[model samples]
Structures are given as structure tokens and as C-alpha cells.
Target: MAGGTDAGAGAAAEVPGLVGVPLLGSLFDLKSDSLGTYLRAQHRHGDLVRVTAGPPGMRAELYCVFSPEGAQQVLASEAANFRKDNAFYQEVRDSFGNGLLTSQDEDYLRQRRLVQPLFTRRRVDGYAGAVAAETASVIAAWDKAPDGVVDVSDEMTHLALRAVARILFGTDVEATAEAVARCFPVITDYVLRRGYSPANIPRHWPTPGNRRAAAAMDELYGVCDKIIAERRGAGAHTAGRGTAAQDGPVQDDPAQDSAVPGGAGEDLLTLLAAARSSDDGEFDASELRDQVLIFLLAGHETTATSLCFALHLLARHPEEQDRAREEISRVLGDRTPEAADMDRLPYLTRVLKEAMRLYPAAPVIGRKAVADTRIGEHTVPAGADVILAPWVTHRHPAHWPDPDRFDPERFTPEAEAARPRYAWFPFGGGPRACIGQHFSMLESVVALAMILRAYEFEAVDTEIPVGAGITLRTDGPVRCRARRVDG
Candidate 1:
């Protein structure tokens, strides 16, 4: 009854759609090549496409908005009409806990109010030293790589994990990074498998998959909980500072100073542990764990994907790589990059932006229409699923003339200004836009600059096929060989 309702008497025709085969609908197609499916749907139909899946008796209808304008409407203008009341979000919330990423309404607002201060430009920039240190470690290891070829995907993933971990856990980075690196993939995979299924056994059941996922969840939670408890009990200011003080007295050098303010060796974990709202409400232990878990999961995986693809693309295109390298050389001839250098290297920043465009970390975003809404000519009735697909919209031919081609110039000032606001959002737009977007860009630009300055890359595995997991995942290794750059 709800599905049949219209926006009004003059509502436009039904949304163009892909009518899948009987029974299973587009399940197999989605499970196989979701990105391709979204792309084809846009090419065949129009922006607003209706997709139906599942059996006749249990059919699920999805209203897909793939145009920049439509995306703006769904994610920004009329964002309240579309809610994260979908199944996938529920799965993420269940496993990851309702941190800023999945929380809604007042809870999200409160979390945002408290967490926003931690991500200010000044504070995030302070983490540049941490990012550079991690990149240096990766470069040092690559210096000894057999034949100079390294798995770019795996290496970036580890590098990003360590970088974020250092900023999050400080001296405890080694232990936390190890546990997270081991446990996050298992949990994310479990979330994906169960999230998409029409039916699932209770997670507490003793099935192999259940047991494995539960074990991973326990291990991941154990590490975070342990650190959080120690921080709370010992006091956030002094808890994680043990190793820093033991290693040596505080250095006067800016490069060697702790990433946090006051040079007290404070990490983001301690900041979160001690953050207080206007009313002096702090995150409880469970709330602290939830925030840390989401930060670990979102912080590392998205940035790693960006760095991997950026390096791979530059490898595939030598001229672009040289240009970027030249900029880095000109800016910082023989010194480590800092927060101030983020804006100094614009071309390198463009390369990173282009890479994100081609392989957005979160390709397909899910939402549900809570009321009858008109998108263009079609009316999406109440209680229908809605999908805002950056994967498809990024390649929309109307704006991006040659969408698939790798061109950093597309992000140049004039070019970017000419396009619609939502046309190039790797981070979703609106009140709910990614809180870590600035942080992601800073980490990416800083790391990419340092790595390119250190080595020249030539892609060995160029044709990387990616799939939509919880985030974009490469189907196989993305390999590249690096030769050290001479001054």
C-alpha cells in the first residue's frame, strides 16, 4: 500500500529501472560486480532508477539516486527525508557500535559536538609528524625490498594503520595496530556477509563463521578496552605518556615534538578519553570504546585505499608521477614534510583527489526514504530503500567529460569550481559528511608527498579490479617497484 502512493496527483511517471529475472532479482549481479551494476544502471536507465531484488513474496525495492543534483537532494538538501534505517547500517552499528558514523538524531549531534574539536585543522595538522614517521618507516623497509617490488595495497594498509594507531594510541601503537590489523578484516567481512543476506543465523550461534567473527570481535575489543581502561584509571594526561618520558626528555625540536598539543605525548585516545561537552559530560567507558573502534576502522581503511590507488595511478602514468615528484622536490628538497607543507604542494594534492575520484572508498551509500519524495519526475513512496551511489555519479558523463581517464587537472581550481558541488564527493556531502575528511586529506597528501619524494614508482600490477566491501577492496595485489630518488 505504501509503495503505491504518489507524491501528488501530478507526480511524474515511474522511475526507469532494471527488471531482474524472477525470484532472486539482481542479487547475484550485485554480489558479483556492484560497481559495474550501478554504472550500467545509470547508462541504461536515467539517474533515478528503481531496482527490485529478492523473491516475489519478500521483494525489496531500492530507489537509486545517481545524479549530482539527486545526490545533493538525498544527502544534503533533503537529508532528513532519507535515514540510515537500512540493513547494512544496522550490521555496521551492531559490530562497530553507534559512534558518529552510524548514530542518528540527538546522539549523533552530541557526538559531533564533542568530537568536532579533536579534528580541527590545527589539531589534525599536528598529526603530520606521525604520518611522516610512518611513511619513513615504510620507505626504509622498501629500500630493502627484494627486486624493489612491493605490494602497494598491503604496504599502504599497514602504513595507514600504524600512522592512525600512533595518533590514536601513542606508545601503545605497536600492540593496537597489530591487533587491529589482524582483527578488522574478519569483522568487516562478517558484517558484509551477514548484512546482505536475506536471513542469518543468530551471531551467538556456534557456527564456524559466527565463532570466528565473535573471536575477532573479542580480540579487537579487548585491545581497545584495555587501553581505554588504563587511560581512564591512570588519568588521560599521564596514562599513555609513560613510554615517551622513559625514552628521553622532551625535545625542543618541532619535528621531534609529540603530535598532540602541549608536547605532553597525548594521543587521540587520551583526548577522546578526557573530552568534555559544554555541559561537562564525558564519554563513558563503553562510549569511549565505540568511538575508538569506529576511528580505527574508518581512519585507516579509507586512507589506505586512497594512497594505494594514488600510487598505482601515478605508476601507470609516469608524466603525472614526475610532475608530482618535481613539486615535492621543489617544496621540500631534503627535509621532512610538515603540516605547513600541505597547502604548498597543490599538484600532488590534485593527484590524490583524482585517485579518490576513480576509486572512492565508500562507493555506494545506503539510506531509506521515510516519506513520499519526488526526485526529478519520479515519486519515491514512503518506506522505500534509497541508495546514493558516488561510484556511478563520479563517472556521470554530463560533468566529467572523460570519466574513466586519470587526470588530476580535473581538480584544478577552475575545473572543480565549474562542476556541481556533489559531482565529486568521495566523502559524502551534507550535515552527515565524513567528520574525518580533512584528516583523510591531510594524511594522504603528506604521505603521498613523502613517499614520492623517496622513491620512483612503476606499476607492476596495473589492472586492479575493485569491489565494494564495507569499503572499496582490491580483488588482488597492487604491486609496484620503487627506485630511490637522488637529490
Candidate 2:
């Protein structure tokens, strides 16, 4: 961060870029094919490329750092120079308010401190049976599917939502989960279009897009309110009992709190609902609502898509699918998976990592430059948006040999050790990385193992159509059938 601008200042101006038709620059190209555009530019322009786009006369800049060196510069080494901005931040904040993902500085730090305890190994290990039980129940419902043709995307979505609802909030808001399922795609689509496009449309404009987004938010907020009210009704002191006031940290054997509506265990919402600050002010209702809403979406949607993509990839590659199923069977031997079994199922972890490489849960990591910084030979100006794309970086031929091929061995300890850390960040790097990474990984491993153990899925169609929204997801239903293989 200390390097003078004189070093790479001129190089920044000379950095190679994509030629555009007009003020829209690469905006149109992004609309047609975003992944293709980024990869193509990374190939032609090397690691540092400046992307600019806007309406006819306006030009907005979005700098892309593709190489691991550049990624390190922004994410780890010089992270202080780059901070979350109002660009994408404003839009995300509008949705979840001041939750963990969108907050910065002291406010973010405080919220992070409060939420981090809820995801520590001690807390997360207690949610495995909840995840496994939900997985079993889902498979049972699949047993009722007439021909066993199931939508893996929808199925995974419900599984993740139920898990988050039951484990995180300690309640099952089924109707809200259903509402998010119905309304989220539209909301994600709207967010992406407005976030990237040169069009500066105000939310209060009441355009068709605005109206649809508003309606969806109403449905989502209605659910959030209900969840908050219920948790608050349980008495804050009761919810806060076992959470924040831990007697230091302690390890334990595998166990899950049967934290359902009628269960005796404490939930995240209940914990926060009961929490009070040093000054004796109780946790604000809005903060609880904001954080819970974030956990619901993040804990549910991203993990669901990751599982869906992993299943899709496994089905496409029979060798990998069989290998994964075999590992699950050998490890559990007809018994359901417990959190402890995760260590024994290395292949499943590799498959999940490989799938994440091909289809990262969060595709693009965006940050704003708080100060001028030198990324390799290019000196990026302050106020610019720095974009680190896992989708592009993971597949870049330089870092990954035969990057397009689906091979889980790429995640072997030896292989991972040989590469740069930023080369494989499904969860964003640095201090602001995802708080739910552990919970997500555990849930995916358990759920993927459970699904493959009881049933094998076959691709209805070999072709995959990908989409980019709040999360990178399959464009349509991932149609596959569940064939029972267990006695």
C-alpha cells in the first residue's frame, strides 16, 4: 500500500481493455454473456484490465484483478486500502439494512463480534443432526414423487431454507421459505440489472421492475417480521442463555440442538433477541430483523445452489458420482451421516470444492478502493471498483491446468498446497469473508452424502444453462430423478 503512484501510474492508463461501441462500453457485452466476456478479457488483457460502461455520454469504470497476485493485493496484503463501497453496498444494504454482509468499520465490527459466536465450531457442530434430519425428510418426500423425476434446484432450496429456519432461527417459516422461493429469482434479477447497468433508476420510480421488486420485498419482510416477533416473544434472557455468554470456548462430541419451535434449544434469533449491550440497552428489534433476514437468505439460498450444482456435475460425470456414493456408503454403512463423519468423507469435500470452482456460490467479489493502490504494474485510482471474479480466476488456464474439465482431485491437499490461496476462494477472502462458510460446507457435505446414499441422480438433459443473479445458479430447474439405492 505504500508504493508511490509513479511506479504504475502510467501503466494503469496503458492497460489493455475491451473496445466498446459507445457510452454503454461493455455493459451490452455483460448482458449477453458475462462469464464469457470476463474470461475473454482475462485471456487478452492479462491480469489487470479496466472495464468501463454507461449510457451514451457517461463512462463508469470497474477494474478487474484476475491474477492471484492482484487478488492478494486487494483482498489480503493491502486489504485496508480497499473497503466496501456504496456501489453494490447501497443496493444490498437496502435489502438487509445494516446486517453482517453490508456493514463496514466499527458498526460492522460490532455486528460481526455478536454474530461470530453463533457460527463457531462449537455452535455449528450442534446443527448437523438438524441438517441430516432435514435431508432424510426431503428424501422421504421424494419417495412420493411418482416417477422420481425431481428438480434438484428446488429440492436443495427447500432443504437449505428448512435447515436455516430450524437451525439458525430455531423455527420453520415454511410459508416464508415458499414466498422467497417464489419471489427471490425476480428480486435477484432486478438487483443484478440495476447494480451493473448504466441506467440510474430510482427505487421509488414505480416502474414495472420497481413494482415487482417492491412486492417481493414485502413478502420477504412479512416473513422476517413474523420470525422476529416469535423470537422476541420467547423472552430475550432465555434466548441469550447459552450463546454469547459462553464460559470461554469448549469442544464437544458431535451433537445437534433439536432447536425447533417446540424444542428446548436456543436459536440465533432468540440469542440476539435476548442480548443486551454494556450500556444496558437491549438488542434493537430492527438489528435482529436485519441480521436474521441476512442469515435466512445467505444460509439458505447460496448453500442450496452449491448443492444443486454439485449434484449436477456429479451426474454429468458418472465416475465422480460413483466415487462419491461409494465413499458415503463405506463411511456410514447404512447409518445416517453425523458431523463427525465429515472428516472421513474427503472425496465428498473434494467434489464440493470442484463444483464450487466451476460454479462458485458467490461468483463476483466487489470492493471499492479507499485509497490509490498499485496492483502489480497497474496503479488503480481511488474510488474505483475492484472486481475479483472466482469464476474467471478459477478457470484461468495459467492457474488451473485443463481448467474446464471436471476433476475433484484438483482439490487434493497436494494440489491445493501448490497453488496460490486466492486462486480458490468460493468464500471471499480477508476480514470480511463469509461468516457462514463452516456451516455451509458442513451442510453441503452432509446433504450431498445423504442424497447420494439413498438415491442416485441422473441428468434429465446433459446441457447446462447458467444464470447470474444474487448468486450464481443454474438458469432453470436441474431436472434429475432420485433412484432409491438403500434398503
Pick by TM-score: which candidate is best? Answer: 1
TM-score for candidate 1: 0.93
* lDDT for position 405 in model 2: 91
lDDT of 2 by residue, 82-163 (tens): 8878466677778656788888888886676666555667567667878988898888888888788888888998899888
| Cα lDDT tens digits for candidate 1, 1-487 | 0122244926578788786787877877788898898888889998888887777766777788888988888888888888999989999999999999999998887777777766767767888888998899888989889999999999999999999899888889899999998999899999999888877788899999999999999999999999988887776744332222212222234332334642344788887776664453778888988999999989999999999999999999999999999999999988999889978999999999999999999999999888787777788777889988888999999999889999999999999999999998998989999989988999999899989998999999979999998899999999999999886
* TM-scores, all models, native as reference: 0.93, 0.92
Choose the strongest candidate by lDDT. 1
What is the number of backbone collisions in each predicted candidate, taken in the order shown? 0, 1
Clash pairs, candidate 2, are 236-274
Q: For model 1, where is the 10-residue window of minimal lDDT?
A: 241-250
